[model samples]
Target: MTSTPSANLFKPLEAGDPAVVGGYRLAAVLGTGGMGKVYLTYTPGGRPIALKVIRPEFSEDLEFRRRFQREVQSAQRVQGLYTAPVIDSDTEGSQPWLATAYVPGPSLGHAVAQHGALPLRSVLLLSVGVAEALHVIHGAGIVHRDLKPANVLLASDGPRVIDFGIARAADTTALTGTGVSVGTPSFMAPEQASAGTVSPATDIFALGQIAAYAAIGSPAYGEGSSHAVLYRIVHEDPDLSRVPAELLPLVTRCLTRDPAGRPSLTEIIELCHEISPVPLRQGEDWLPQAVAGSITERLRLPEPAKTPPPLPTVAPTPTQYAPQQPQTPPPTQFSPQHPAPGGVNPYAPTGFSQAAAPTQSAPGIPGPVPPPGHPMQPTPPPGYATRPTPQPGYHTPPPVVHAPYTGPQQPKKKRTGLIVAASVVGAIVVLGVIGSLLPDGSGKDDESKSPSGGGSSASSTGGGSGDGEASGTDAGKKRPDPKPASYQGIDVTENYLVMLAGDPPRPEEGDPIYGGGDLSYYVDSMFGDTWIGTDNGKFILLNNSQKGSLETCRTETRYTEKITLDQLSAGTEFCVLSDAGHIAVATYKGKGGAKESTYVTFDLTVWRNAEEAKEED
Candidate 1:
């Protein structure tokens, strides 16, 4: 019986499936992949785990078994934040199996297929995570050989690179001798495509392809027959025209034809960090809102079913029992006087049939039934604790304990506190008069407070209200409303305009595109309609009758849907809340001639909550 929102992701166990492996009971089938079938299981302490059992055909081969064992060992040593490390494995057994930490999220391939390409910021964050995973894998003297979208799982916080060492185990298998390519064709490096030596650089090339695939909802190298795609990978340049401009240079560098020319993992991480300076934490919000919600749904896996109760030793004998009343008995109400042992009902419906039961006492047995409410009762068992008899229609009440009470004590006499209060008040008044007559002991005027100069207070505090005061604002006046970061007359066209990084307002571009992909908004011209939306942020059109101010944008709730240009007017204003927690109000300025071009313009003013900005600092 499935009970969770994500229970549909798992399939019921088949008749032939092993109930237990390595002492862990299998709960459900996660899915089958190229390597093996994955099952949802739990450790002895009930921590959820993903158990991968190798296919029988692969486990039968002596060479495959040897390689699998070695790879499992190396994979066990790999401990990285972005990787699902091997928890347990048994390569010597008839059915080789390994368990890893179960990350609850859809695969990157599924996410992209369901929700187009990720925003530029999400892609950059993904690159950093995958690069970090590769760094750890390579440091353990293992080449991932296959690094593609399907191998990466999108968790709520970040990307988790799984199946790290499985590909290397299958690298020298007999299948390769049959002219079968070891890795995915579209994501393969030039060297790997041509059957050349594979190294850490090969994984780097694949990482670049994955990044490009994530930026655009397709492979870097266009899809085709295996041979055709492989040929293009080895001989032709990738179709990077649709890749986000900020990620273009980095992708190009990693996809370098020559293995030696490809940048190292450290360099790749550095490139991503340069593009997005903030360090990506393990549980940071990096995925698009829609994708993040999908991950959250996957995390709601059903709780494991309770262990089945042991079969009864002898069937119950009822005076007027009916034999044709179905093999299972009706559900019974359990009470404190007669509880189910191990929390399992012996006669409850179960998957296993009664015919398979052995004729002997089983560990799990329902406790003795309670006697009907009557004056006479049967004797209790030796070890059973005795309980008070419950009434015919009511449960026995719990025992109540009473506190000891002493005799009533005499009331204390009420104090005349008015006299005491008057005395204290008179003393405070006398001290105040004395303090007024005291001299300016320091001999320095109150105006000479800070030695650094007249603007010392302003200089010490730096930005915000300090800057306002330093700019000749009256001290008695309230600190002026915070000035928002603004950018004007931004032309948003086919290419995404990263509102977070635009000052003079230009398309996402830079020298080698090192630090640009901070996406905030984009213009989509699909189905002959121009729409304004975001892939990494939230957007809500407030109204078309009047323009919205910064305060309105900050307070308004934003939705994750696009607004058509027709719904917008010269006076229309909407709110954009980026994934990075920066909120901005974008007022529609104008658009290119409807027939001449497909572009819209907006004047955007960005603001970060003072608390958020201070935390970043």
Candidate 2:
């Protein structure tokens, strides 16, 4: 069966969001709230359901998952006419989600806002239905921790309680984890507002708040800030002026300050039945005509589109490794490896003849030509200077800046005492190299490119034999320290660190005091996750995330211009932002004048003139 439309609450799927969860086809988004997003979907058996996918941040939290899983188990046991039962779930996936029978109705909060206070008769039915659902939920050992107007659905038959996403076992201590409280403070129970232990009575207190809202189209406690509403809930009595006199007794009892003083759901239900104009039943029409008609329209609304198809997985040529048999030599020990004279990785893997290399390469990616006809050996990609080749005893070095690319190059290191004379090709036999290089699929352009100004004189000698002989003594030497050009006296870190731009292009040995670069390098690099600022001489990392706009380098990063990286070292503490997906550092001279500050502004203007390109290829 097709799912229903979300009444303007549905949003089109975004990039990176999944089209299917487990097996259900997600058609349209129902809504998005605090925990994650809810989608309109259907089971294979044609059962319509609302599926909620946990957000990335919440999925990554181990503690939250535990509580969610436990709460889901309890929610499944809740069976009530006023509650949407949990039908399916996957709490162990990379991102968790739960599916429940669809309740195609607007929230009580929405209904009240759109059509004013529900009639006293409807409110009485709403009160009775929710109280009964709570009875079932509490009996199943679950407490609806975040019960507010938004969580209460105004179904034609009665009100349905939903969004048990944060519900937890009534008996569990420290509901989720330390230092985290989840609930809408405006409608939260007094104990919850004070961060006290939550129980079934806690839900009862919140129920009273929702009932109050449904009666007056506003909160019973004065509508101000959250703190104000919560203060009134705890310290003062609710303003019963707007509430019809009939609901005052039941509402007041539920809003009692003491959890023990509040009447049980059974007691509230009996009182509601006494006052309800019509007998409450499973199919009772408790909602007014306008409100019930809205629900009817929602259920009949057609889903505008079909579920999207799954995205295709395209495999790039370079990362395809050909299978091979293990080579058996004199079982020689492995030794340290070095790059060829021009800083080329002799062991770079070549792509299969069937696939041609793409012209646009990621940073540090090298195009290696295979030898005439020898067995394959492990080869590093063009721009990847830090991935350790799976060969024993030899250490891989950084990518080289060289001219005149040549045939498949072998690693510059060797086994201490093993040299096979197996069938050979052009002047040499390929060693234990594998077929194809499997670089990460991310579009990293680390190919060896010379910095704009001029090549720096700074260079280090890689330790290895001048001839093709394997020297175990020199092989064990640590690969020449990572390029010390990013920071003074320290090697540039692999993976996390990337030097966006700086005064010298490379770092100095003593300190970065006088060495700095244009602040606009951040704009040039388009690495929107970090921000760097300099005051006097010492450079500090700024909180990029708080920078207000994502176009700025400091959009989502923790370090802000106000914070200093004085306590952090480049490699050990933070790394450069390279194709290897590591930390990166950008530096420039003290406030480098206005020339560097306006870097991003200049780049945006270049976009219009892109039609005036030098080469199309």
Candidate 3:
């Protein structure tokens, strides 16, 4: 999938994220929310799962952790065709996390936003599936207080309910202080809106809102400020005019201010079945074409990279020695070995017994007699005398030298001690050079690069011995770090930490501070005004915009001299293509600088260039 399209859906894992949670290895970050982040992981059996880790701020709460543990136990008992079942969880661990069977599909909210409202028939089918899920949930004494379009995933089989019971666990926490409700404002029941009491009926009210959302493109209470919507929900009647006539009556009953007046899940399911032509189980064609395509793409996610294989083990072989013959000399005792000059290891059998050198007799001289325990000495050939045994404290006479004989000779074993020693030394030297040349690959090139410039000094070393090879590698050792695709909420100044575009589009003084090149963006007027300019690229200012608009730089042409700090009070965001050719986003984030007294600040996030990103992918 393209990063631009699913940019909001999936993200690469960030630093400090645990690679393994419990026993499941995290594959990627699914999405983040106010509570915590959800990740895509797999079970030991290779089944895909969605793991939701509780944020540290909440996990630190002893009360929240205890309630969370109870909720997890209850949620596990909820088994239904239309619910994403909880498969595993760890509530007592350092970081509590819950894992559920992954549902591969777009959420109801995303589907409605991407492909308008669902048709009448599809809405009925969705109602039936969601009602059945709620019936199962309530039967287990669990209430999905937080049920909305975002929590319902439209799977190929049917709609699947998620995030059940998690809201109830947080119901008594600091999040629900006094008048605050645990559920969403747009779909909360009247009682929940006022924080009086919450029950299974609250979910029925949310169910009505979800159906209306699917049939109509927007929430029934209408979208705006949360307080206004909650007030309307509590006192005012819902606007079901846009809702189809067939779904209007049920939606109205479910949205009743009095939860006692709402119909039970069974009745809702029966009513939906009366309208649906096909059984809810046969929902192969339930979703719209556009939504189905997105679901298919999610189901076809590529497998995660596999781990490296373990090292091999060598089995010992049995040692076998040829039977010693009478003519062969006996083996000698092992002696202490000295290393060769240049610190090389001398030739020595790794596991085998050492053999002794054979004795060679002089041409015409008689051979020395054996020790007393040996067999009788051999008779001297013809009239030659046998060597006499040496007396105590007396040394034996040396054998006499003679002229060389011209005759056939036996082959002698080749001496390979020196050759083996040289080979071992060369291998060690090569490994050392290779290790020195290997790049650290940490991607901190901008700070780690040699201050003298590039690697001119290092590369000047000529190649010959091991040192030359190591020096030659230094030139490439300063590999440019991966250019940052984007930065977030970085505080920058004009002189010290000016915004610059390069490998990392972070807040740092570069050409702008050195009086060399133009600045991408700089603070001025003592936190009152900000200047915007690029060396060769363009910038587009959004008067009243959301952060999402900064995802891509607009193609239309326009430029403003500067934006006053007061004009950006409505969260104005600007998109600029840096001279480095990467798209960057900047948002006014109040007046305060890192070091300067009262300077303008902008939260910046830069993305890699489209072509460069594609090439790297």
Candidate 4:
């Protein structure tokens, strides 16, 4: 068979280069690496995708090809909003490649290198986005294995995880090559450095280092050679002083040396929200779009009617697969000439059939009964079967297997007979050794055990009760009863609630409370909605939509006397009114000591209108 043309291999057809291998028309070179080159490619249609072609030398290695196939399967398992979905793959082709949805943006590393440190807002967004990705990846039982700045992209909409070529499943058979390590050294965990093992915690540690790098524009362990960085990861604590104080607790949790101690991805997402300006919402419309004109320019090509056919399957080589199980051992038979002594015998006749005899009983349970064909043989009369005579420094032979025989079985046998026998032997040995160490109690007098003052048992019990009562009385005198109804200065109305600085306010359940923060911050709402104050002093506005889903709005405003609901303005810009009649806004006012109010306005008309609409539908 003749080999394919070299010029046609992974060459772009759209750039005045001839179409190569199988009708694929590569548009632009995306990136090149030691293993392969990634190219921006398109079908006959205008749809664009990123295609990676494996290097020729790497393709020759069957083991590498198998791993690549497994990677494709693992990558395909990731299904979430933040992950770039895997579209197709050609694992068996001359140059195996996988295609994923083309995400438009600079790699995080490139973004940081060009733009310097990201602002706090962007970092928060990145943290939440990446955490979401890891959550999905981990849920699928796979580790990204190489989570680094280069593998993370700052896309227009949000952060996206890319390059899962080396991802491994928790239960997968793939093993790291001896003396070989994967992942960038700067971000690897100590366990990863020592080639110990990788797990979800490994990703958490890596994320902590990444967060530290993002915060300070430097690695948490500082700049150094690969070896030095690896050493620090294995032996040193990460420097997290530059991390924002608010986020320090979360970062510390993630940087724990023990994998079991790391906080989960969900916890990291919550931490990001704690420091973010935008409260996480399900349908927030702030998703950034791809950079203007970038996707269109990159995907320039005629749209094909359909995706290319999958490549033919290749038979895996012998060395590429793991050995099958159920390994069988050589069979051996019992030797009758073996000697038995001291009630101990390795070849003792266990009450089991020949077929089941080889299998040992579970650690503590007795062996199963022998099959009907294999009955227990009677024990030989004492001295009939000669016990081996002891020889100086000579090892004795093992016990012989007895022939099967039918006989009356022993009923009601005690399960702990062996244990009792061993215990009795141990007790006799202990008593002989300790018999002289303790004094005899024969001289003790029964009268000496009586109370010094002669008294009946009933009298003694009565005295104890009196003493107990006296101690209880003294303890009660030392501590006063707590005051009832601690909150005295707050007020609650049907529509709102107010908390005074002097005392915390208490509201009965179902009461619409407001006024922890800027109560005057006006937000437009659908008709028939209500707002309530939360224990955190923020207001939660609820729209009584038919669906019964509540839209929550958190405000930064603090409750103060100076602010009022009437002073706030209503407009489309500062409010979000759901079709079911819910609206909310976040507002804050005044510095320290200044009382701020969060004003929430409910529109009964909008809710009524939504109800009418639903009725019409």
Candidate 5:
């Protein structure tokens, strides 16, 4: 049976209707939930922002309002490169509302539904970004009680964390009322399912589920009724077999049933870095881009159309056979005349014998005897009582009788057909086995291609091949290529630290700093603050707190040349008019960038080389 469509699904709205609350005017409705509506609104300066207002019933509760106010305050303190920052809020207003920087992108749920699960690289990036966000939030003594795919946004830059309404401060006395369960069942941690106090580890558990979903296109625990899902969360192990072998361990750690057993967000960040090392080339950023024409030309192929042939028809064959005739009786009494003594009658010659004789007596023998030539009838004996005679031309076959005898008989043609069918199937199976054992020889082009140029020999190396050998030529004795000489020395410039690495002749002794290519890399501390950047237009601000390391960075918005950062210095923020009649800002801090100055930006193509030497545990 079809399900009833949800009332919130694609509801219409009239133009010019005031969808706003307080000072923020809602340009469009972004989403809705059990609590309230989220609108895509604008700030006074026309900067796009997401505005969330409480439901009218919840707004009247002073305690809820106070709790929400504290949540907003705590959310505002979250500092990272992967979280949206709270731009403004008015808890004291008649209709309380909170506005955050609008991150234009699809929700993780929407993205996964539309495009299937993300690639391994993208999943890695998402996990790292979300974990970093959680780390920042937890460091500020806040626990995001509701961490699900719906609250995660996949912006062009990377994944951004959102939804802080139900978040709780670690030291606050405020708690959700009894019987009010929060969080999506599929993404909740064991403690959260049991309605126990949530911690940063809870968010980590939720992130693990989200990662599993992103990797396998479904939740690891599977989907069903909410109660069933919650029970599985508490009592069952997730199906992590579909997860990439390289990431299974990390995901398993995050999904440990015991909250205390789960890895910390700090550990998650390190794992992400290890699994998905940042590439060296800036052009290899995760952002989607159209392939070059030449590349597409090389990969494109035309499909051939197939058509079925007409079926043949067969005609039915006719057979010729003679019908049997009944024997006639003698003229005197119109009855079967007994053979002289033991001699058989002339009509019952050869195959027809006494066994074929009818049991009935002489026909038409009565007081009014019928003449001969009339149809034959049975007559009773004088001493015995007479019975009514049966009508002529009506005959009944005698009951079948069997004699016990043992002898072999030829099998039927139908049985032969079945044997032929079974033999054909067996032949097909044997041929298939033989084919699999033999070498595939349609052509070299039809053969499987390996990452290495050599054919798939037993000793062949590299990926995309069937051979079970290492990719490197000197697999047994090879060491990693050394970090470039250019990257060895450090150069500090205004707002940057440049490390230039030169090419090496062979492998390096220790872990290489930058082996992929010759590029200027920098890590420097200015006024007791560390910053890393490339000579190219990329930078990462590193902030160390008692909790962990936080990284933030910013890049210009495409088409408008607006420099968007994690946080902008007050006097440095300004707007410029674009040539295309668009208003562009000189610099604007990203949610994470504005809150904390930790940023990371670099060429990601170098990762391909690093991945070659990496081993899965």
Candidate 6:
């Protein structure tokens, strides 16, 4: 198992390592921890896999075996980036073992240790991806008890939370031994250190620590002996002075000793997204220069063959070893310092450590190599987020599972990468009013009463098709022109679209239109795909507000009541409010309540330019 496979992160297997596990040939060592040893292996099809063989002590225990089986089953259900998904397992065997998708990226600890504090933007993107992964992980009912930086793999896609060895289903019993704490001291939550009930919040606390470490290049709690660090985590306030100011509040909130006081994963995503929502595009480098170089070194291994012998199952063998999904690496180079189009350099240059890392150059790496004379002020190759510069050295998506929200999901027919601008964060924001977009900023006074704040109203959130609220977008023959067009009080262009939150209601009145309704929009787009954005509350417009008068429309105004669409969030009902204060549950016509925008799956209801949009009945 010492053939030097996998990217730079994996090493030659030791003498004690097994040559094969469950029919998959072990190639090298990925990592080792107190829980078990992780080896790099490949499926019969040549797809890389990380095989973790549990120690005899843990596997021999009947209770541990059952727990491992259940945990692995639970881990298999988890498909998001928070933790690598389980590909296969053999808990019933003498020594329980599990295999997962292999990520050719460095751990956060190694990246930070080699390069110093990560750039502010990288930290923000890291937060978004990790938080979203946590959201999905929790949704799967699994709590990753061990979520330290070492457990976080920096893939070409984004940060991937891995190593579910210590993870347990929230409904399971604690696996505590006599005075045993099953976690890294510096990153453990106070409750975990004190042997209290471990919950999702424990992971939140560790996330704060990860953030602090990535930002400060050291533990948030001053480092010392294991006991001292554990004590500090349990008793002392974290030293966040070194943390960046923009991230201070959220980071502080995550570190709150009281689990109840800490912000929920939802809040953390919202807040961190407000600071930096979009992360690196697939194949876009997010690690420091030295670390990216290491990743390149690792990717030198050839991809797992299309079809390898299947894991020992009573059933037939798989023709291809790779995951069913197509993970073609982008034709780009590796230059974390400069991102290609549709991308950005998430790494910050603050306190950049220049220590020479042990890692070597990857084959055909898209990295920034210094020129003959001048310093390495290299321009990154065009990536998905930006225009595609199909050059050498660019990272492709490895088999490793990444944060749920991470990865490059391009818009239909567009190959561009995505870049979620940091400047946009507010979940709901009102761009400048467009006189033409809204029939009239000041609607007919008699018909327009402030929007109804009453109980019976409708709102459109993330994903929904019910009650004809906001239907999906129809890629009708109509394509938004790049030229700015005034549509419904927003400046519209091919690059950005303007969306509105229906008019508000006046006091004591139910919604005059459709009783009462709320409006929200979300633009999940890739590069060259126009997106209706929100940087938290950065860009906002009050409901029923006047053309230039913020005082005019004073009905039901609440920016927090907004929803971006997603497939799982369908059936949520919402009314579309108009400037005239008319509420609409759905833009349906007949008794069946047929809907428009049947093909659309985002928050776009109206077009600012009348020429392009034909409002159909």
- Give one digit per residue, the lDDT tens place, for model 1 in 417-519: 9878988999999999999766578644334346555754453444344233433324445554445777778776544545453444465632111112233
Report clash pairs, candidate 1. Answer: none
lDDT for each residue of candidate 6 in 1-617, tens digit (9 for 90 to 100): 24344555557767777655554556677777766788876654456778888765565455566677888877777788545777777676666677788887888988888888898778877887888888878887878888898889888778888866354521112223222334678898998764456889999999998998989999998888876786678777988888888889889999999999999888987787677646434347655577677677667664332333322222212322222342343533212222222222112121111111112245544323222222322232211123354344343323446677867877776333333343343322434344333546444532333346231222212122223333123223233222211122222222122223322211222211112112323222221111122211111232222231212222435432233332113322233334322222222111111232212222223322222111111
lDDT of 1: 0.67
Query: Per-residue CA lDDT of candidate 3, range 268-380, in tens?
Result: 98888776666655467877788888887786553553662222222212221223333332321111221112221112211112232223245554333333223322232
- Which TM-score value belongs to model 4? 0.43
lDDT of 5 by residue, 442-520 (tens): 6653343433435553233343332233544437743332221111112222232222211221212220111111222
Candidate 1's TM-score: 0.50
Model 6, position 283, has a per-residue lDDT of 44
Whole-model lDDT per candidate: 0.67, 0.54, 0.64, 0.50, 0.51, 0.54
Alpha-carbon error at 591 in model 4, in Å? 68
Badly placed stretches (over 4 Å) of model 5 are: 1-19, 165-182, 277-284, 287-617
Assess every candidate by TM-score.
0.50, 0.48, 0.49, 0.43, 0.43, 0.47
Model 3: how far is 258 from its true place, Å? 0.8
The predictions' CA RMSDs to the true structure, in order, are 24.1, 22.9, 27.3, 27.6, 35.0, 26.3
What tens-digit string does per-residue lDDT give for candidate 4 at 1-617? 12221232224344422233223444556666545567765533344567666655555555566777787788788988878877656666555666667776666676566556666666677777888888888887677777888778666677788765454421121122122233577888877764456788898998887777766677788767876787688778988877878668767887898889898888888888877766854322223233223323333333322433333233323321232243332321111121112111212221111121222235554333222222332232221343444463343223448979879878986779898999999999999889854545763333333565344332333433322222321443422221222222132333343222112323332312122221222221322222332321223322233121212232322232222333433321122222122222322221111123223323211111111110001
- Clashes (backbone N, CA, C under 3 Å), per candidate, total 0, 66, 6, 35, 38, 87
TM-score of 2: 0.48
**CA deviation > 4 Å runs, candidate 6:** 1-8, 165-181, 277-285, 302-617
